[model samples]
Target: MNTYLRILSYARPYSRFVPVYIVYTLMAIIFGLLNFTLLKPLFDVIFEQVDSEVLLSYQNKPDFTFSIDYFTHLFNYYFLQVAEEYGKMGTLFYVCLIIVVSVFLANLFTYLSGVVLAKVRAVVIKRMRTDIFDQVSRLHIGYFSSERKGDLMSKMTNDVQEVENTIVQSLRVVFREPATIILYFAVLFFMSVKLTLFTILIIPISGAIIGGITRRLKKKAVESQQSLGRIVNILDETLGGMRVIKAFNAEWFMARKFDEETDHYAAVNVNMARKNELASPISQFLGVTVVAGILVYGGSLVLSGESTLGASDFITYIIIFTQVLNPAKEISRAVSNIQRGIASADRIFQVIDTKSKITDPDTPLAFDSFQKEIKFEQVSFGYEDEMVIKEVSFTLSKGKTIALVGPSGGGKSTLADLVPRFYDPTHGIISIDGHDLKELSLADLRKHMGIVTQESILFNDTVFNNIAFGMDEVSEEDVMEAAKIANAHGFISEMEHGYQTNIGERGAKLSGGQKQRLSIARAILKNPAILILDEATSALDSESELLVQEALTKLMQNRTTLVIAHRLSTIQHADEILVVEKGRIIQRGTHTDLMQQEGMYQKLSSIQSV
Candidate 1:
C-alpha cells in the first residue's frame, strides 16, 4: 500500500482536479440518495395513509434542523397541501416528476466526476513515465552490461502500462466506492438503528473471506510480471539475432525456448485470474446471506408491533441496504486487481529508486580546454576480482598518435575505455593536463573527446541527424563539409533523398564502407581534442577498409589519438606503439625501434605479412 501511494504522489498540485472531483462526487451521492429517500412519501401518498391532523400541524413550516425527521416532515407538509389542492392523480404526477429530475441530476454529476478523474489519470501517468525514462537514461554504462535490456524495457513499457490500466483506473474506485457504501449505510441507519447495527456485525465475515483470497495474490502477481519480462527478453533476443538463428538453422531451437517461457507466463496469469475472479462471487454470496438475515430479523419485529418501522419504511430500508452491496462487491474486486498494480509499481520504483554509481561531484573542477597531455599513472582496473588492466602507465602528448597493438583480450579496449571514464579505475589515477579526471564534470570532460568503436554505431535516422548527433544548431553546410572530408559525400549524394534519406535500423540500408565513413564523419564533425579508435577498420572488407582508413586518417589529424589496432600494418607510422599482452604492457617504443627488438610486436607483424 505504501508503494501504491508513493506511485500516486507523482500527481502533484492536486488543487486543479481534486477539489472539483470532490464537489461533483458529493453532489452525485447526495442526489442519488434522495432518489431512494423520496420512496417513503411516495408510498404514504399512494396508500392514502396521511393523517390529516398531522399534516395540518406541519403546515406552519417546521424550523430547519439537522435531524432527518425535520426534513421528512418539511417535505410531507408541502406534499399534503398539493394533495388537498389537486386530485390524487395530480399528486402522483408531481411525485413522479421530482423523482425523474433527481435521477437525471444524479447521473449528470456522476459523469462530471468521471471527467475530473480522467484528467488526474492522464497527468499522473505522464509524470510517472517521464521520471522513469529520465532515470534510466542517467544510469551508468556498466549497469546496462549487468542488467538485461528487455527487463529495463519491460519496466518502461509493460510495467508502466499496467499502472495506467489497473492502478490509475482504480483511483476512483478507491474513493467513490467507499463513499457510496457509507452514504447508503447512513440512510439505512436513519430508517432503523437496530437493523443497521445487525448488518454491520456480520459484514466482517465477508471482509475476512475476501482478505484471505487477495493476500496471496500480490506474490502471484509479482511472479506473473517477472515471467512476462522473461518472455519479452526472449522475443527481443530472437529478433535481434534473427540472422544468426536462420544461418545456423536453429529456428526450432529458438522457438522452443520462447514457447517454454510464454507457457510459464500464461500459466501464472491463469492462476492469478483464478484468485482474482473468486473475490467477486464470494463477496456477493456473503452479501445475499446478510440480506436474508435482515429480512427474517427485521420482519419479525414489525409483525409483533414492537418496532416503529412502517411497512413502507421497512421496504425502503431493504432497498437502500441492497444498494450498499453493489459498492461493497466492487470494492472487493478492486482490492484483488490492486494487488496486481502494486506488483508492477514495485518493479517500476525499483528502477526509479536506483542511484547511478556515476554522478557529478559537488563543486567539480571546471574543464573547457584540453592542453599538454593525458597521463595514466599506475592505473589498474578489474571487473569483479578479475583484473583487466594492471598498473599500466602511459602519457599521450597533444597532437600525437599512440597506438596499442595486442592479441585479443589483452585489455586494449579496456584501457581505451578508461580515458572517457566509462569505468573508473579500481586503483590508480588518470589525469588530463595535470587535473584528475574525477575532479572534472563528466559532461565537460567528455565534451573534448570523440570515440568510434569496432561496431559502427549508427542510428535509424537521416544522414544529417546521424552526423550531427548530440549537437545543437549545426548548419547543413557544416555537416556536408564534414561528410565530404570523411569521403562519405559521394555515396550520400547518390541516395534517393540524398542527406534526407532514412537509413534503416543501425544503417542497415548502407554498405559497410558507407556506414564506417558516416561514423568517421560524425567524429570529424565533433572535431574533439582527443580521439579513441577501437579497431575501427578491422570489421570492414579490404576495399572498405581502405576507404574507412582514409577517413580515419583525416579524423586523427591534429588530435591526441589512441588507436587499438588489430592490423599491425595500419599503425606502423604511429609516433609511439605499445605492445600489450595479458593485461600488461610487454614493450613500448617508436615503431621502428620496436621492430628492431625480436619481441611480440615483431612476431605479430610477421604473421600479418604472411
Candidate 2:
C-alpha cells in the first residue's frame, strides 16, 4: 500500500483535481443512496399504508439547514402533499420518477469523478516515465556494463505499463469504494442499530482472511515479473544472436530455454490466480451468511413486536445492507491486483534510485581547448582486485601522434577510455594541459576529443543524422563535406535517399567499409582537437583500409592523437610508439628507432614485415 501511494505521489499538487473529484464522488454517493433509501416510502405509497399520525407529522414543511435530515424531512413533506393531493397510484408514479432522476444524477456524477481520476492517471504516468528515463540517461557507462539491457528495458516499458493499468485504475476503488461502504453502513446503522452492530462484527474476520490471501500475492507477483524479465532477455538475445544460433545449430537449445521460462511463468500465474479469485467468492459467501442470519434475527425481532421497523422498512434495510457487499467485494479484488502493481513499481524505483559513480566535481575546472599535452603520470587502473592497466606514463603533446601497439589482452582500449573520463584511474593522475581529469567537467573535457572504435556504433537512423549525431549547428553542407573526406559521400550519393537513407540497425544495410566510413564521417563532423583511434581500420579489408587510412591521415593532421594500432605499417611514422604487453609498456621509440632495438617491438615489427 505504501508503494501504491508512492507511485501516485508523482502527480503532485492535488489542488487541481482532488477537491473537484471529492465533490463529484460525494454527490454521486448521495444520489445513489437516495435511490435505495426511497424504497421504504415507495412501498408505503404503493400499499396506501401511511397512518394518520405519521402523515400528520409530515404535514408541516421541515426547515432546511446544513444536515442530512433536512433533505430527508423536506422530501417527506412534499411526499405527504403528493399522497394527499393524488391517489395511491399517482403517488407511486411520483416515487418512481424521483428514483429515475436520482439514478441519472448518480451515474452522471460517477462519470465526472472517473474523468478527474483519468486526468490524475495521465499526469502520474507522464511524470514517472520522464523521471525514470532521465535517471537511466544520467547513469554512468559502467552501469550498462553491469546490468542486463533486457531487465532495464522491461522496467521502462512493461513494468511502467503494469503500474498504469493496475494501480492507477484502482484509484476509484481506493477512494470511492471505502467512501461507499462507509456511507452504506451509516444508512444500515440508521435503519437498525442492533442489526448493523451484528453485521459490523464480521468485518475483522473478513479483513484478516482477505489480508492472508493478498499477502502471498506480492511475493508471487515479484517472482512472476522477474520471470517475465528473464523471458524478454532470452528473446532479445535470441533475436540479436540468430546468426550465431543458426551457425551453431542451437535452435533446439534456445527453444528449450524459452519454454522453461514460459512454463515457470505460467505456473506462477496459475497459483496466483487461485488465491486472487478466491477472495471475492469468500467475501460474497460470508456476506450471504450474514444476510441469512439477519433474516432470522431481525425478522424475529419485528415479528415479536420488539422492533420499530414496519414490513416495508425492514425489507429496505435488507436491500441497503446488500448494497454494502458490492463495494466490499470490489475492495478485496483491488487489493489483490494492487499487490502485483506494487511489485512492478518496486522494480521501477530500483533503477531510478541508483546513484551514478561518475559525476562532475563540486568545483569543476573550465576547459575550453587543448593545449600543451595529455600527460599520464604513474596512472594505473583495475576492475575489482585485478589490475588491467599497470603504472603507464606517456605524453601526447599538441600536434603529435602517440600510438599504442601491443598484443591482445593488453590495456589499449581501457587506456583510451581514461582520456574521456569514462573511468577514473585507480592510482596516479591523468592531466589535460596540467589540469587533473577529475577537476574538469566531463562535457568540457570531452568536447576537445573524438573517438572512433573498431566496431562502428551506428544507430538505425538516416546517414545525415548519424553523421551529425550529438553535434549542433551542422548544416547539410557540413555533413556532406565530412562524408566526402571519409570516402562515404560517393556511395551515399548513389543510394536511393542519398544522405537521408536509413542505415538499418548498426548500419546493417551497408557494407563493413561503408559503416566504418560513416563512423569516421561522424568523427570528422565533430572536428575535435584531440583524436583517439582504436584500431579503426583493423576490421576492414585491404581495399577498405586504404580509403579509411587515408581519411584517418587527413583527420590526424595538426591534432594530438592517441592511436591503438593493430597494423604495424600504419603507425610507422608515429612521433613515438609504445609497445604494451600485460598492461606494461615494454618498449617505446619511433618506427626507425624501435627497429634497431632487440625487444618485443622488434619481434612484432619483424613478424609483420614478413
Candidate 3:
C-alpha cells in the first residue's frame, strides 16, 4: 500500500480531477440508492395498504432541503390521491416507470465517471513510463553489467501495464464499491438500525479475514512478479545469444534452462492465483452465513411482535442486504488486485529510487580547449576485488600518439576507460593541462575526447544521423566530410538511398567494416582534441583496413592519440609504444627501441608476424 501511495504521488499534479471523480462517483452511488429507496413506497402503494394519514405525515415531516421536502410531499400527496381514484394496479405501473428513469440516469453518470478515470489513468501510465525510461538511461553503465535486459524490459512493459490496471481499477473500487456499501448501510439503518447492525457484524470479521489474505497476497504477488522477470530474462538471453548456441549446437541445453526458469515462474503464479482467488468465494460464503443468521434472528423478532417489520419494509431490507453481497465481493476482489499492483509498484519504484553513481558537480567547469599534455601519475585502479591496473603511469604530450601493446587481460581497455571517466581510478589521479580530471566538469572533460571502440554500436536511424550523432546539429557537407575522412563516403553514396538510408536494427543491414567506418565518421564529426582507438581496424578486411588506416593516420597527425592495438603493424609508427603485462607497464619507448629490448612487445610482434 505504501508502494502504491508513492506511485500515486505521480498523480499529484492532477489532484483537481480526483475530487471531481470522487464527487461523481459518490453521486452515482446516491442515485443508485435513490433508485432503490423508491421501491419501498412503490411496493407499499401497490399492496393498497398505504393509508392516506401515514402518506400525509411522510409528505409534511422534513427539516431537510426544500426540493427534497417538496418532492416527498408532492409525490406522496399525488400518489395517495391517484391510489384512491385509480386503484393499486395503476400505482404499480407508475412505480415501474419511475424505476426505469432512475436506472437510465444511474448508468449515464457511471459511464461519465469511467471516461474521467480512463483519461486520468492514461496520463499516469504515460508519466510513469517516461520516468522509468529516463531513470534507466541516467543510471551508471555498471548497473547494466549484472542486470538482465529482459527483466528490465518486463518492468518497462508488463509491470507498468499491471500498475495501470491496478490504478484505474483501485480508483474505481475506492470511489464506487465503498460508497455503495456506505449508501446502502445508511438506507438499511434508516429502514431499521437493529436489522442493519446485525448485518453490519459481518463487516469487521470479513475485514479482518480480507486483511490477512491481502497481506499474504502482497508477498506472493512480489514473488510472482520477480519470477516473471526471471523468465523474461531467460528469454532475452536465449534470443540475444541464439547464434552462439546454434554454432555450439546447444539447443537442448538452452531448452532445458528455459524450461527450468519457466517452471519456477509457473509455480509462483499458481501460488499467487490461489491466494487471490480466495477473496471471492470466502467473502461470499461468509456473506451467505451472515444472511442466514439475519433470517433466523430477525425472523424471531417479527414473530415475537417486538419489531415493526412490515411485509414491504422486510422485502426492501432483504433487497438492500443482498446488494451488500456485491460490494463485499467486489471489495474483496479489489484488495487482491491492489496487492498485486502494489508489488509491481514496489519493483518500479525500486528502480526510480536508485541514485546514479555519477552526477555533475554543483559548479561545473567549462572548457572549450585541450591546450596541454594528458598525464597519468602512478595511477592505480580496481574493478571491485581485483586490481586491474597497478602503479601505471604515462604522459601523452600534446600532438603525440601513444600505442599500448598488451595481452588480452593486461588492463589496456580499463586504462582507456578511465580517460573518458567511464570509471574513475580507484587510487591516484589523472590530470589534463595541470587540472585534475575530477575538478573539471564531466561534460567538459569528455567533450575534448573522441573514442572508437571494438564494437561499433549504431542505432536504427538514417546514415546521415548516425554520422552526425555527437553534434547537436550538423550540416550535410559536414557529415559528408566526416564520412570521407573515414573512407565511408564512397560506399554510403553508392547505397540505394545514400545518407537517408535507414540502417536496420543495430546497423545489422551494413557490413562489419562499413559499421566501423560509420562509427569512425561519427567520431571524426565530433573533432575532438584527443582520440582513443581501441582495435579500430580489428573487424575490417585488408582492403577496408588500408583505407581506414590511412584516414586514421591523417586524423591522428595533430591530435593526442592513445591506440590500443592488437595488430603490431598498425602502431609500429607510433611516437611511443608501451608493452603492458599483468597491470604494469613492463616496457616503454618507440617501437624500434621496444623491439630491440627483446621483451613482451618483441614476442607479441613476432607472434603477429608469424
Clashes of each: 0, 0, 0
- For this target, which candidate reaches the highest lDDT against the unseen true structure? 2
Q: Tell me the deviation in Å of residue 606 in model 1.
A: 1.5
lDDT, each prediction: 0.90, 0.91, 0.83
Off by over 4 Å in 2: none
Q: TM-scores across all candidates? A: 0.97, 0.97, 0.93
- As for candidate 2, its clashing pairs are none
Ranking according to TM-score, highest score first: 1, 2, 3
Q: Tell me how far the alpha carbon of residue 107 in candidate 1 is from the true structure, in angstroms, after superposition.
A: 1.8
Per-residue lDDT of model 3, residues 95-161, tens digit only: 7777888888788788888888887787778889999999999887767876888888888888898
lDDT (C-alpha) at residue 205 in model 1: 95
Q: How do the residues 562-590 of candidate 2 rate in per-residue lDDT, one tens digit apiece?
A: 99999999999899999998888999999
How well does candidate 3 match the true structure, expressed as C-alpha RMSD?
Answer: 2.4
